[model samples]
Target: MMYTQEQNREVEKVMKAFADYIRDTQHFDLLWSDKVGYVFLDGISEEHDDFCMAPIILRDGETLCEEIIYHIACDVMEEKGKSHDLRLCGPVEREEIQKRLLPYLRQLPEYEHLVEGLFEK
Candidate 1:
């Protein structure tokens, strides 16, 4: 089903927040595709063909999108910081994201479930 207006607004919120975060810290621009639930044309990674925020946007809802944004923050831009790290080298792996960065991000409101169901050991 197509996203309702309210849900679309949530997507915009998440996209804007993420774009702003990218601009402020990375000094670059981000392009997002709602149809595909991925961010591309990032001015950061020369090696970066592209990056996908996990779980898809419309299908996954904004809460998870927010978590995915934080996931990109911690994995792609922050910790890895333009590297060949496995996290950025390919499509985001939920387990890898949860394992490598969730503990640090879990305190943040949006990332509280960064590992919830997926990372249980």
Candidate 2:
């Protein structure tokens, strides 16, 4: 997850572009953590079950759009329990997410292409 100055800057550019894409097609208030390089969007409605919310994670020296979509899938699912169970276990860890949720998300035809097109070079 460690990146050089140039790498981080590049990621910021890609994420901002991604956010702009989300803004165009969806209604969300985006908040970003440059520290962790994740995009957080608020104001999601439960009525929109078809919506896919994923984090934008920069992997290795390149940004694969699929990985970003997978992270967002994980992000949305992790928060789902709050509405369903009404229990606050704690914040979900990135490692835990990648370990458990990512495998399932990779197969889903959800945000894969949407994010890929958004970050086209």
Candidate 3:
């Protein structure tokens, strides 16, 4: 999923907007990943929780990958209660998430067609 120049610009814009949103809303800095060619939103509050946006030229927006840790219910495990369960999800449709960030993305041009025809299939 290589990013075109324009696509990368959009990604940079969105990353800036999202980072700003988080900083303003949460009053903290996100622990960004140091990977040279990847965009990641690594939360500092907890380890192993990250939001990665991989650039895909086919779509105007990047593909999202979320890593989260879910705690097992008390009834599910007693000895393992303190253990962690990590779930890696997505490569999901950007449209499914773009809606929630509409307020931010809407500011960009082509907001209406940003996610058009942007599925892996």
Candidate 4:
């Protein structure tokens, strides 16, 4: 879960790029969908299912989509760790840690990469 300053910056850059892409290209309110298992860059309605409304922005201007995606990516990476203590920490702790690390992770350039990977088959 510990990330370097450089990695932090990378996450931020990627997040910003993603937000910009959504704003300029997609032009719809992007939100996270747990059903589809990735962030969707479009508006939602009452009919949508299995989706969680996400915060769109942080005080520092980072997007929530990027933060969530980064957190998921980190979770995926950490899942591979061969330590009982780490595995025992569980998804709850992973989510909590992601929330706590939002500020630093928002600054990472890999944010976009993580998001992009979400849609890759």
Angstrom error of the Cα, residue 35, model 2: value is 5.3
lDDT of 3: 0.36
- Candidate 4 is scored at a TM of 0.23
Separate clash counts for every candidate: 0, 3, 0, 9
Residue range 6-121, candidate 1, lDDT tens digits:
66665565555454454564423434464655343333444545443333334333453544445454454345455533334434454555555444344344535544533332
What are the lDDT figures for the candidates, one per model?
0.46, 0.44, 0.36, 0.44
Between candidates 1 and 4, which one is better according to lDDT? 1
Give the worst 10-residue stretch by lDDT in candidate 3: 66-75
The window of 10 residues in a row where model 1 has the poorest summed lDDT is 52-61
**Candidate 4 Cα lDDT to native:** 0.44
Check candidate 3 and list the clashing pairs: none
lDDT of 2 by residue, 1-121 (tens): 5667877665555454455444553434334466765444533566654435554445332343344444454455555543222122234533343444344336433433443332232
Q: Give candidate 4's error at residue 107 in angstroms.
A: 8.2
- Candidate 1 ranges with C-alpha deviation above 4 Å: 22-45, 48-57, 63-70, 73-111, 115-121
Model 3 per-residue lDDT tens digits across residues 39-103: 43433343435434432222233432111101111112233332222121123323234444456
- The TM-score obtained by model 3 is 0.33
**All candidates' TM-scores?**
0.37, 0.30, 0.33, 0.23
Q: What is the Cα root-mean-square deviation between model 3 and the actual structure?
A: 10.8
